[model samples]
Target: MSFDDDPGRGGGDPADDRFSTLGGTRQTRTRLPESTGDPYGSTRRPQRGSRSLVMVVGVVVLLVAAIAFANRGSDSGSSPDGQSPKKPDAQSTAASGTKPVGGKQGGIASGYAHDEQGAQSAASNYAVVLGSEGMFKSSTRADIVRATHDPAVVDGLLSRLDQAYTPSFFKNVGLNDDGSTPSGLTFVSRTVPVGTKVAQQDGASATVEAWCTGLVGLAGPGSTKPVTQTWFTITEKLKWVGGDWKITSSSQTQGPTPVSGDDRASTADEIAKAVQGYGGFTYAR
Candidate 1:
């Protein structure tokens, strides 16, 4: 079964809204009133003072135009060709300046630094593990729970998760009662984090959100459940424990989804081979 097909599973990805600025100068043109038959039909000559005033006004207009030209030329953000640089979006997939944590526990990234970036990193990696195929099995699920969750909530979370992935649940998803796939079928469940954000943080705690995409299902010839992709956001409340970040609680919500494209689905064998050839990542902020 696909991850999103299960009612208990949560899904989503972050959506970004972009905005642009527009600017223009309004010009007011003044014109002298046309002569109305030149009172008494007499031709009039311009006075010297009137001519001098017109010269002054013309000079002022030229000075203002020059200043406007100089200001535009001095805009550092514009290129030599006069186009403004395209600003980067607020959210990006680029790597953060902070270095990733150097330690690992139970094969998962651990020992994050004590900062908001650290919390974001921890949340991303935890989201991957929590949404992985291992969560469907008893032994590996326990290991994952213990590795990612705070010690205080470990037991309770384990019990709840164990009940959630019952034998009936396994059977419904094309897996055996013990959570094993049938012969010649490969069960796939993987989550890749797109980006992370620290929603709120303090010296000892943080609330982080992880936007992710995942693939889940049974892949093989004649498989009833074909591999499918899903997007989701995971919100994790973390606490500083044992000198590292640990999940105190977590929840998931369905997507800021993108429009689907028209593409052909690959054969089950191809999907199975791709899953085997690809390796998962240890995410960082």
Candidate 2:
């Protein structure tokens, strides 16, 4: 079933009709008829008044244009020799200049640089771990929480999450009471960060937002809860602890979701195989 059709998984309408552009009304201009015979019955004197007005308007427009051009040139960072520097392409998906971290902790990327970019990377990776299928299982969920959260919050976060992913919750998503998938079915829960933004940062702390897309549910021929896609933004409050970024607190809101696409849904076998074949990335932006 489509995500929207599943009452258990609440989501907004896929039709993006919330916003619309208002049509502008056209303005009509009435032109005065030229005096064919000089209504005053005297010489028009070449309409010097109108001619002077036009000249004044033209000069004003030219002066404004010249000023604008001068300002633009100054702001464009042109060299002293009057040539502009080559700009990097806006559409380029180039790797960042920061070096990748060399280590992992508890199977998750760790040892991030202690900078804004590092905090962003940490937040994104944490989002992925928190949104994974492992979070549904008690044992792995404890490991994930301990690895991703600050030491002070790990116990409390683990306790809360354990309570949240209850037996009924597991069954609702086609998982067993122990969060295991039924035989012959594949349970899929994965989050891929599309981008990261540092909302706030200081010497020891940062607030980062990870815009993510995820797949969750069961993938199999007879599965009632087939894998469905979701979009969400995960905001993490991170602190530089133990020489690396760690989550102090985190929250998720539904989405800055895109409209649903027209692509046909893949079969359960194809989806299961693809998930098994393609590994997720270790985001570092």
Candidate 3:
């Protein structure tokens, strides 16, 4: 569910595997390393600006866009491999032409329509907010919980996550004990949704899975947990409560991950600069 700064966890947060293929033999033909692992056995050392993160995010983005573009006047898009219809009618790849939300509640998107499209939108945006660096802080995390979760569950959820995002957790991710970024460094924890799928849905309840790639850790010179990317999927069970879709329960797993790429890694300065320069989008279907 959660990953730690320690690379030993084998979670593959980032750059965890460069310099692995220094020397190796090929049989009859040259074969690329397995998309999953480094040359150094099973563990991968995090590489700054790891190509895996960039490539995964890029591929997912392109795949989503291409599918949407291909499905443009149709009722719905096919699954990634074109094996099956992603959903029934009313399911779509384009916007619903209705406003995504009526307004913001505690700075989080709110008032999504009581429909499958609305559920997807709600899940996408919630994934971004929940995975943001802000969630590491107590005050901001509380606000996020109140804004996105069902009222009945807010208190309980906060109590649980408070224990989870403890000082030790913050420290592991390169944050100060108070969850603040150290001076001269930037903390990055952002989730960009690659796509959303409605796994199950009904009139008042739904389960949406957000396939996402995220950036975490610190970005600066000589940083220990240098900014790295991670691939993970967030599954949220939501209810159309009080005129809006709100999270009732949510959990994360490692990934519906793609194979690693062979692109050269960027420098820490480049990664930090890119994070600052590029503004994240308000994701939707």
Candidate 4:
């Protein structure tokens, strides 16, 4: 089951064709075939059975440990029936040893600083903020791009982002022509990550996935736009730049989301009006 605190409002997957493109956990730097796909017919071999047994036992142990850790909290993961609420699918990712950044103060967990989880967490949070409502306004954009993006990418990305946040895009998101709100309308575009993982990790870098759900739109009197949700993946190229793990580049993509439910839908006017009245939050894993 999907678990969004708001229980309302959403987006089709959006992507940034910038310095680096984003991808999901499935979008790994390398593709590995299942054990059943023994390209050389090695599956028939039995000489290495002893070694294989050791490996299998080790794997079982690790899986048990991981499940225990993840389930440590009442709010973590899903229940036995597999229907616990989670963050967006895009927020957790990894590529082997590499992990997403966990916190800003943790510094660059990249370059294999021995903190893969922290790195993945950092990347996920950065992606959420970069793809947030702040991206629409010039001032907020500057702050977000500066804070979340690497300096090397800031200048060029800012220019391109400005171009992308065109007047039409603003209108599409239920904002005014200038990307402002109507007197009473509240425009919302918020992304909250459910969890993060390192799909593939290396000493220097790891592919991180931030499985996320978002709310975007406007709410106010006479407004037609309503809040909606979406799922997507955000792939990032993280570098241990400066003293921290800065995002050298990133990109987005559509889900991997589930089919919509038959829940009663909210009216457009109500959605629009509600958007104007409610404020968004800073989501976490």
Candidate 5:
């Protein structure tokens, strides 16, 4: 997950270092300790039993109704322009309220505005393209580099990437000398952004971190590098150029990963089929 090496081809640091610490979800149920006997059992004191019961029931009903009404109000709070209200997590982890740029360059999403939010959106989607299987191919790699990096740095970055994805490297990842998979195998390399955060912001410059989960390796019978998932985060330093956010420099590091799940791992054929059937998404914010 660094510029110097290619984890997409299984040639880099050990995955133990690339895992994130933020993907686990667990639920717990709690119950109050049960009482062995009623408080008034030994005292035998007369209580306002009927009246207290009625009062408690009425209070509980009022409380429940109040909570329901409050939640409804929270959910229905919309913009004056008839747009949906942004979620509470939007500012912290969810997609921004701003819409994604409605354009593409060399098949990669582009036209990000000159702002911190836009920079974050651009970095996220760009990360997706850069970490994909397309990077292994010469034509698509050139297009991705051109689309994501600033014009002045495009040539240099592309040259460095070209060396990184050498034929030997491709062979190590179960691809041929030209980065093509064998007839029966499917090469998979896809990066999925989980969240984005702006680390710094200025009028014309910004640094954003895109937390991502990726799938890499080959899938099929007798495949040496069976597809596996990894978690990592990419930081992109961007500048406002050509009326959009473009990468000046970028680096990736091990993740803020979570614990592995309990689901059974699918076979290679199952993985290949699933990958082919499911299309990827366009990330923003």
Candidate 6:
């Protein structure tokens, strides 16, 4: 995360949607009151104030070029929706040696605990898990559902979700239920948090909304599910549980996204090949 010249702080890294309506007897649900948080809230994230003084038009153009360049990559490289990766973060690092370290657990995110940034980081990371490929895999889904979400929603949400993941869904992701091999396809399901903000914060709790983009697709021969992009916001109502931020409840909604550019969409096979051939990084704050 070098801040030498780029703004967006030396602005970031990337990857990459939805919300639900409420129903009666469904328990108390708090809809995320529509607030965009602070899109330009770099005041808290800055280590020095010197950079803020310069807002060169050429620099803004440079930043835009940088963003576009950073986002250009394969499906395996970014948020499922193919957005740019999270730029270098000042707070999180591979050296931080955070949770579930390297294994089946390698995908587990860490570094959040008591700090306000930590709270927002946890919510942002958890939001990614809440919307990943694991959600469609029965066993993996169970593990993630338990680790990231409220316990009450685990069972019912799982049941309802199971119904939603039809053969059509699996076919789209190049997966076959029973968690077996789905021929030559590489299944792609991932969520990338573009940016996170502390909508409201206090010592014991925080509300962090992770703006994200995602992909749910099949990456093999003869598959119809095109790897498409989606934009959504995930508002996590977090509680400082056991010294770590845990999601008490979370909800989603559609885009606060910008218009798409004319970048050439990659082919299903090219996307699938990329997914299978590549791996993911452990996202940090």
RMSD of each: 18.2, 14.8, 17.7, 22.4, 16.5, 24.2
Pairwise TM-score winner, candidates 5 and 6: 5
Q: Would you list the C-alpha lDDT of every candidate in the order shown? A: 0.82, 0.81, 0.81, 0.63, 0.81, 0.65
- Once fitted onto the true fold, the runs of candidate 3 whose alpha carbons sit more than 4 angstroms away are 1-98
Better of 2 and 4 by TM-score: 2
- Runs with alpha carbons beyond 4 Å of true place in candidate 2: 1-81, 85-94
Write model 1 residue lDDT over 25-82, tens digit each, in one string.
1122223455677876654453233346568999999999999999977788787789
Model 4 TM-score is 0.56
Q: Indicate the residue-level lDDT of 269 in model 2.
A: 95
Per-residue lDDT tens digits of candidate 4, residues 17-42? 22221121122122234476667764
Score residue 177 of candidate 4 by CA lDDT.
84
Tens digit of lDDT per residue, candidate 2, span 1-285?
A: 443443322455322333311111112222345566877764423322334666899999999999999997768588668997788785324557676465898898999998887887788788888889888878788888888989999988777877888889998999999888899999999999988888899999999988999999898889999999999998899999999999999889999899998999999999999999999878887
Q: Per-candidate TM vs. native? A: 0.69, 0.70, 0.67, 0.56, 0.70, 0.57
Candidate 3, 259-283: lDDT as tens digits: 9899887887888898899987766
Ranking by TM-score: 2, 5, 1, 3, 6, 4
Q: Which 10 consecutive positions of candidate 2 have the poorest summed lDDT?
A: 20-29
lDDT of 4 at 223: 66
Candidate 4's C-alpha lDDT?
Answer: 0.63
* True lDDT of residue 54, candidate 5: 66
Residue-level error in angstroms, candidate 5, position 249: 0.8
> Candidate 6: misplaced stretches above 4 Å?
1-107, 150-181
Candidate 2's clash total is 0
lDDT of 3 at 57: 88
lDDT of 6 by residue, 1-285 (tens): 233442232235211001211121122223343445768643433232333324455689899998888767423566767885787775432333434222223356643657666776687668777777777778787788667655656688678778887887665455675544467766677788887777888877788888889887766678766667889998888877655666777789998888999999888778977777876654545
Off by over 4 Å in 4: 1-114, 266-285
